[model samples]
Target: MTQTVTTSAVRARASSPALSGPGLFTVLLAAALPLVDFFIVNVALPTIGADLAAGEAVLELVVAAYGVAYAVLLVLGGRLGDLFGRRRLFLAGMAAFGLTSLACGLAPGAWWLVGARAAQGASAAAMLPQVLATIQAATSGGRRARAMSLYGATAGLSMVAGQILGGVLVAADLAGSGWRAIFLVNVPVVLLGLVLAVRYVPETRSPRPEPVDGPGTVLLAVSLLTLLAPLTEGRAAGWPLWTWLSLAAFPLAAAAFYAVERRADRQGRTPLVPPSLFALASLRRGLMLILPFSVGFSGFMFVIALALQRGAGLGPVPAGLALAPMAVAFLFVSLSGPRLIARYGTRVLTAGAVVQGAGVLLIVLAAWRDWPHLGFGSLLPGVTVAGAGQALQLPNLMRIVMSEVPPARAGVGSGVMVTTQQSALALGVATLGTLFLALVPHHGMRDALVVTLLVQLAGVVLTGLLSLRLPRTVG
Candidate 1:
């Protein structure tokens, strides 16, 4: 069955270019929006809270609501694209995302903003998987590798750039909207993306269409909500009894989701996530490694932003500017990732992890030495080094994970990979950020941040170890 699917997908790819050069750019432009939105709002949260009269706990909810919903429904969104068409879903999602961004910008209350954010996340889930799927279905060989690399670069850069752009927008407070400008900014971008998508983005879908796995879909959603909801929201909500109970149920729900998916696959039905996809060792292990890398990366970003602004008394623009060195280093190094991956194979990832770990250690040491006087200059060495290290790891990991995924299962493959990444990112913030906050009340903020950076350093080491299990080289 897997061979047949691969053969069919290869044949489809042989027929035509799914997108021209200009069209590919349009797809990538659309792809960057969700990732940008994810990180952009982090810097704006405090401003949003002050303006909306929201407390810290509610502010956490505002972020988690989008992430959790986005993670939970991703597989379903991917499957829908497979069932219908990639271009169609892409356009629909883009339109909805634009409307939701508008809703978020105009929201008068915290709860209303939170709801709009969730809607935006859902639309993002619908939109993003198609980017990977279309690339997969449309291209192969060097074309495919180049496209994936561009996607990886876009994904990594958007994360860092989002915060920087958000700070500028909020600080500028265009038309007195203040924090709302972070979201409202998406409206114009989305509109431009819509225009380009309609003109250039080509429609693609699985050549061998399979029925949607209704039971698998429901089980997966339940499993994700069960796992992610409590973890993300629990820390902010004071870790009530229900949160603990929810955490306990996660493993069981996950087991059930797998069981249902496996049964569907054996019965020759299209499972929400095909069991066969896991047979690709590169894809499987690359995904496993993505968990720790994504989690630690996100945790570090969230905590460091808070530490710079709240702990060190930097304003939003300065806080955002402080990360500019990291972003610049990330982009510069990331462009060379494909060449490095070709030469050094997965060793590049290991090298990146080692560098990143060292960078984290540097940050800890800097915090210890500088204490209350920490500034961007003091933080520069560690952030630049760490950004270079991350630039090496993230894009390479993305290429490795998707390397063996046949075009026919592109939607499922991309969905599974992204869901793991998104979930881990949320978990990192919940666990590490929570630990920092918990320790801050007891220890000084400087000490707490140092300890948290050390914890992230450990995660980087684990990722380095996991990279050893990957294939020697990526496609």
Candidate 2:
């Protein structure tokens, strides 16, 4: 009877109260961890390769494994949160994340670390969507908007900070851990997050949660793997025959996944990805902007890290510190984002793109002229301006995404949005990073870096044009 009563009470806790300040902080912290890990390894990769005796192909696997796993499992993780309870899932995922981080840090070999990183990503898939879903369900009106804005700020900041922090950690070599310090650092933070979550986070779930869509799940996984797997690994693997075969299968798999989900929606079943969800113009258009935005952001981070260290002959610390101006600029502009949105609305995005383009051009000029001499001083102006422009775009863009998503389907909405963002980040690394590396062998690093930045500038232009279609006023 006591056990039965406890079960009932657990279920009774589903209707969460408004998210408190501490609760919001807790979720936002959790949110930053995954994204931080995504880019953290950039500065640490060289040390990791040398220490583990791993080659380029295996090193690429270490990054791609995490990204693909994170992207593939995200929606399912969100759905599970809805059915079981979000707070419950958050705790479980956080625990798993801490354990996997420890595993990555302690691994005896490169393959072991790669496996652990994949697990780390899978755990992130379970944890991250809950951050947005919790905000969507537990807050509303202006509070909802504010919470979303904060989440976005945290996300954009984390991506930049990750590499910075990784450089610090790797250089510090605390207790002689070297590159292992990056993964080990997550363990302590995760433990703190777990404790705070239990105390401050509230239980929430769909009032009418649906069962998992198994077929849709499988097809979605296949679709992402078919495209991302080959691309991320192809260049490293020397474009193997299997990579070509996988790339060829991507379209067919995507088509089948869409048809399956559309059919499920038509049948009145809750598909993993509801086609009806895209009917929300805000979500749809916001996602369209996110794809290019994330692609450039991630690609630039990866390529710049490589170019600075390998081409400019900088160490990890110097390479990461060169972007300090960008991080500082991003923070300042991001804080003012809500005010700007209220005043100028979507025009801010266009203005941001233009400013960001100018920043990119400045960086190209710096790279072309400075070449091996390019250091923090030479790169400062361009990176600072670019960061500010990105600040205007990323956080506000995120607010526009969930602006119109209904509260009940918040889990699914957050899942879909994040999946798109994560997949794009992976592709950015795959495509832009590929382009830069491919150019380096024939063109040398300076020309390759300049060309890559030029390509990214083109993407910034595309993002600005897409922003024009965004609703003038996001709710």
Candidate 3:
């Protein structure tokens, strides 16, 4: 009798509504908010500092605080979704995100803003994993592939648009809100998302959800903080003793985390991030590709933003507009990705790398020859090709990473993949951003920019090499 009842319950849950197109749109909209917020502040940081009398270190915290909190809690959020419900957490997270944005908008001081931003990051961590997990549970085959592609499109476009929109909002100064408008703008969008989510989004959760892995969770948090904290804050904070100590502790924490997770897997217990998940050729190689690609992608974004604004004397709007070519190219190419992938398989990623490399080399030459006169016209060819290449790479990689994930393990798989990307993003900003800033003082802006592009090209080359090792076709 007990076995019969359990099987019936499983069937009932599986028979629930699959994700409709409208529902997919709603969840993808939710996914965009966090990423947008992550990059939105980049352009507004100078304005924020001037208005709040914030120094460099505090301003860095404004960014770092949000990133650290978002990353640390993501895997836990995924597990929670599996244990309770995805739609439930989605609504809660969206509501919390709205309130936190309001707090950030109204904050009167630097520390207050930092606190609010940290809370906002926590809210995002709660929200983002459900997007991928929900899709994984609700869709299959071609539908799943298309949804993942759209999600990737939304993510890439949001990162670029956030900086663009931030520039516009800060300049527009709606009712004289200035930089606060960047955050305040999220309120209405979140409100709309909540309404749609309640109406259209289907509820989903793991059929055999496991209890939270406490030891694995703690070790993972320690491992990330020990590494990311020092790298992000070390230069601005004068390389304090504590920062060095944290850096030294990272490898130890990481090793311990791996050991614990492996032991749990060996014992047939589900860990926060199961070591067993990496056995999939697609997931493993896909992640290896994503790390280098993300590092280069974000590093280029940060370095270029600084170069255009600080060195070239362009205002925020113009600086943001400079990437319009890339944005447009990414959108068009990504829309066509499914068709391309159907025909060419994973070789598309290799082609993307070659195109992106060519674009980077073009940018390097243009910067070298044009110097401070660089503008939209001079950068159009390079940015457009690079954006197309990125379009080809990012969406397909995301689809590949989760291609083999079972519906029951969807939440864990999504969480692990996102955590890896988020950590790489933060690391990119720390390492590449630091390198660019450090070089500028000695080598000057143009030389520093060129050198940075060269380094990014090297990373792109590495990604191409790694792509060769992936299974020739995705599931």
Candidate 4:
């Protein structure tokens, strides 16, 4: 009789109505923090390099260190959340992130700052997977859609806002710390998130607990670190032999990781990432699309930020403000995303890709026409249109990816998706941004920017092609 009562109560909690108002707001806020940190540091890089007298390679590591650590540990973090409790991990991660952000703000040396940044990324990995997991476990149907949409919008907006906020803080030089202010600003925001989260966020985890695949976790981390670390830091560090070796080993490591996970799963063990998760066609294809989409997006932002500041002679503020049109356009179009997805389904994503491609083309043309005179006004239309296109796609893509993720596997699913995205983003900045910079010395900045935009256009086309494989409508 006691066992029956306990089982019924568990089901009741799982089937309860979705969070609303403050509860929903808290989740979305938590979701936005990692993305905000990702782009925020870009505009501050030059200032940091200047103030710290850091070399370009070390500076690139500062960014890459955070991203690589986050991407590598994400799956394990998710598994840990499932084994423990998402709320427990979320609170702990958020607290660590705040403290690390403080460390970043107060670092006296370049290496110390880099280490802190890595720690910050690890904390983000711990915190981020829970946002989506909690939403999945706690919400369903229309409520879930709304929560996911808000999460997507916050992500997109935060990416833009990070850069903008970084500029403002760097320029303001709060407490006369210059670029350090960008990180320092997070201290108060994080404290607030911690306070609200404790009050409003409910605890959640997999109802049927599963054992962590220890070996799978280790292998997965090795695979990601081997792949992402080199790709991100390689070009900046002049592509050492170890970088080439690491890249070469990626396929082997990935295949081995897969083999091990598949073996574990077949044995009725819970691999850190279950193969069953990919059985959902929408989730699989949606993740495929996310990779290229995120890669291009990050590449564009990183390359453009550098071009604007170093090439076009803009300050941090102006460079950051240049992305404002994209943010505005994204916000406006994203509000109508769900309705559009309901009507047109995956076709909307295709349309967004085409529109984004056009925007990139326009950017290429603007670069061609404006040459040395490229300015915020000149770049506005292209970026605005591109932002509109992205707004249409990103939210819908997110909805599709999470559509079929069983509540029980939500943590792992979110972890897998986010890891793919964050890894691709880091690589994009590393590869595309590297290509642009490499070309800048030989061909002028104008030509370099145009070429990079064209390459990104190809990525957008790939996204369009992949969209056809996505389910017509999300569950």
Candidate 5:
């Protein structure tokens, strides 16, 4: 009986189509777009506000809308890819993303940009899961290892590059388009991605795709929206009555969603996020680390961009370039992650968290001392160490999360993981960004920046503690 099962598995492996070299590159390029857009708007927000005559309230919406939409719909997007062809969904989503990006660039007002950004986020949700699913289904052994490592590296680098590139684009004001150039730039890249995808990317889908979990999907959506919406918009909108009510409803909605999903799993039906998936120790523990790391990372990005530009009185180029050392450190360190993991195991993550925490503290000290005079040189040491430490954590954490997820359930697994990461990102912006903003009026910009960095340092420490629980040796 065991021999027969082994033979069947071997035959299934033989029949799977491989993801070619160019195909892998195309999907990685696609993966980079959504993450890049998430951070790209940070440095450009001031310009966007001026050009559109948008207030702080409306400006927050521009970022929140996209993040909420992306986080809420990601799991559903993955399931759809499993039912339909991954390649088909990838192409369709890419087309929608391009169109929405065009709308964003052409938007005549603040509300128009917000709506377009939400649409763009939805499109990203549809496209990104397929990249991970394809990599899981199409590659194996050393090839799979290499591909996964590259995907992790790409994810980290793209995030840093997004902010850096945004600063440059806003400063350049190409074709006199100003901040709009940031969104408009995606148009040409998406067109190129679509062409490459069609010619090189292979189609893949689940062998026995389950029907969509309608109840679970709706409940999950409710749970996320109720929690995220009010938190992101509440302070900006003067903490309206609706925000409090929404916050009150969140726990109930979350409880209901969990109960429904659990019941569905027990009855041998597939839920949107399978309860069984977390049985993988690597995935479960790795995700815990990812949540805190992503939250702190995003919050720091948003706050630092604002602080350098407003408090330190730097131009967009200088504000963005202040983080250049971090980006360079991340890029170089990430290239060697696979080798480090092979030798050091999960210890890399713990040490990374310590290193990152030190960097955050250094920045806090700099802010306290330098105040309005903080520049690229003054901020160099902290950002470089922070970036190097982050390089160690994010890529390895991602590889660990997906390490034990079954190839057959790759779409859902990737979706679950990305959703967790994305939700934390939104929360980071809402929570830490709000804290920083709230403090600025009372404590002054310098004090607020210091306090925010200290808070982020605590998060880094928590991430280190969580990393201790991850499987000693990842798959």
Candidate 6:
């Protein structure tokens, strides 16, 4: 009787609508939106500031607001999908994202843009988790692996392509839209995503859905705000007393959040972020690796945008074009990732780190040798090599992270993984960017860039060390 019931349950799950190519494409497109938006503004910030007469601090808020909102609300978004339906939340989030992007594009002042960006971030938090959750719930075996690889490729490419696209759009200045084009472009894409999502995507949810965890949710928000707010805005805001107070409160809030989660787990209730999930080696180690990698990745993107435009005297288009080599190289290597992972296991990630580190060294040497002459041609070799290295690691790391998570916990697991990555990206911008900016005045652009690259090299080495601990074989 027990065997019969178990088999029936398996059959029922297998019978649910599986994700097709079009469906996967749609969701991957959705996944690209938030990440692209995050980096797209890097090259556009100067234009935005000039056009709006915004100060340095307000411009920083424009970026920090979106990141903080996205990071803090990600877990809640995931849980909501598990409770209601992934497809439904995805559609609603997509629509809201479109509307918010319009608001951003139409903003009259700096504070207005900041508010719109915050709403856009919330919409992204709601939309992005469902992509991973849907993929987890609907596919299995090699098919799932392939979809995941594609998703990773899209993610890596989006970060680079975003800056490139932003430059192109800003240069085009469609109907005199200027810097606003970047935000406005999302409206049409979101509209298409909604249409396809309705036609192609399938709805899925946890069989035993749990209600929202109020205390865990509140504490998590507080914890993230306390940590990220001070770090991102402190330098721009002159390290005010409130920033210090917020930084001091971070540890306590984080600890309290953990305690509440632990208590909820013991009492047999769902928490916003379950502490027990970290017990899985794949998840814990994968996140550790992701943190350093994402930090270096985003920090480099931010720094390079600033350096190319301000230090090298390049226009927005030229500044964005400098990264083309990296984007192209990343796409090529990422496509070959699954086959390479099959043959070499997790060692591939270690190899990627080594290659990326070598590329970073090359970039540092080039910066030192050719400061004023730095351009697309000078950056070609280093960026190309680094992109190839990143391609090898990111998708494989994503696969390893989710390999052991059961389908029932898909939403939560995906939430946690994305939250970690998003938070690290923000941290990267805060710490490395702050360091670079501070050094530029005293040490000059060339020396400041060299020092930053060396620091990033250290992070790459740490990522390589962490990769060694991952499981030898992946599912």
TM-score of each: 0.96, 0.97, 0.97, 0.97, 0.97, 0.98
Tell me how candidate 2 scores on lDDT.
0.93
Q: Which pairs of residues clash in candidate 4, taking residues 3 or more apart in a chain or in different chains?
A: none
lDDT (tens digit, per residue) of candidate 1 on 342-374: 788889999999998888888899999997777
Q: Put down candidate 5 lDDT per residue, 1-475, tens digits, no spaces.
A: 9999999999787648799999999999999999999999999999999999999999999999999999999999999999897899999999999999999999999999999999999999999999899898899877887788889889888888899999999999999999999999999999999999999998889888878999999999999999999999999999999999999999999999889989999999999998889898888998899999999999999999999999889998999899999999998988888888888999999989998988898888888889889989889999999999999899899889999888889899999989999999999989999999999999999999999898899999999999888766778
What is the C-alpha lDDT profile of model 3 across 293-383, one tens digit per residue? 9888878887888898888877778878888899899999999888888999999999999998998988898899897988788888899
Q: Write the per-residue lDDT of candidate 6 for residues 216-246, one digit (tens) a residue.
A: 9999999999999999999999999999999
Local accuracy of candidate 4 as per-residue lDDT tens digits, 384-443:
999999998898888889898898888999999889989988989988998998899999
Point out where model 2 deviates above 4 Å.
1-16
Candidate 5, run of 10 with poorest lDDT? 10-19
Alpha carbon RMSD to native, model 6: 1.7
Candidate 3 vs candidate 4: the lDDT winner is 3
Give the 10-residue window scoring lowest on summed lDDT in candidate 4.
Answer: 13-22
Q: Model 1, stretches more than 4 Å misplaced?
A: 1-16
Superposed Cα deviation of residue 57, candidate 6 (Å):
0.4
lDDT of 1 at 409: 83
What are the Cα lDDT values of the candidates?
0.87, 0.93, 0.90, 0.88, 0.92, 0.94
Predicted candidate 1: what Cα RMSD to the true structure?
A: 3.3
TM-score of 2: 0.97
lDDT of 5 at 461: 96
As a TM-score, model 1 comes out at: 0.96
lDDT of 4: 0.88
Best by TM-score: 6
